[model samples]
Target: MIQKAQEFMNENHFADVSRVQCLLRKMMSKEYHGLIDQIKEYQDPHAIFNIHGGNNLIAPTASQAEQKLVEKPADEIKKDKE
Candidate 1:
């Protein structure tokens, strides 16, 4: 399970903190079981959000639309995409 989480993190950039939490919930259970806290503490917030054009391929800061998207339910976002 840890391996799966690592892979998912590798593929997906942590732009929205809530999105990361949502993933942890889906991947594990109701709670991330300390995973979210660990990431926040260990990882650099700027790097996670890819604020600078570093070699690491992380996501950029969340735009206004993205902020709103995060506020919406996952189901609603999926529906909008469809």
Candidate 2:
């Protein structure tokens, strides 16, 4: 999971910081030492959106005209198509 997260950060140019948790345990882990860093972390509020994942992709909503088109009588729609 950490390696996956590392890749995500690398691709997105991000640095990880716990919302508030300290990394004392991680820092103590020799296995993670090479992957760890001590630095000031700041949040860019606008950067909260996803860049790669379509997770943030919003489905386009039907406009009032579109909704009306759907609600129109089939006969009326057929007449317009003619």
Candidate 3:
């Protein structure tokens, strides 16, 4: 399964393996277990969704959309300056 994922990523020119790993980890969470199971049983692991710059390939999901929101660190918080 991992091998097929790697091949799919390579074939699609996915440059961020770490990002993909993070996404996979999130998908494996209990909250998404059912979705993962369904995907594992039916979807092709090699399927790719080309996004941003045509270099970033990702599986489409709500979490992927949520990840776009940039988070600010504690030190960078505006209230910290006050």
Of the two candidates 1 and 2, the one with more favorable lDDT, higher being better, is 1
lDDT tens digits, residues 15-78, model 2? 5554212453343455444333322232222323232343333333533332121345535644
lDDT of 3 by residue, 1-82 (tens): 4435555454455355566555665756554433233222122344333244434456444344433434565345434444
Give per-residue CA lDDT, model 1, range 1-82, as digits (tens). 4334444544465455466656776767434455443443123233233222343334345333333213555456446745
Ranking the candidates on TM-score from highest down gives 3, 1, 2
C-alpha lDDT of residue 75 in model 1: 54
Name the candidate that leads on TM-score.
Answer: 3
Ranking, lDDT, top scorer first: 1, 3, 2
| lDDT (C-alpha) at residue 49 in model 2 | 27
Better by lDDT, candidate 3 or 1: 1
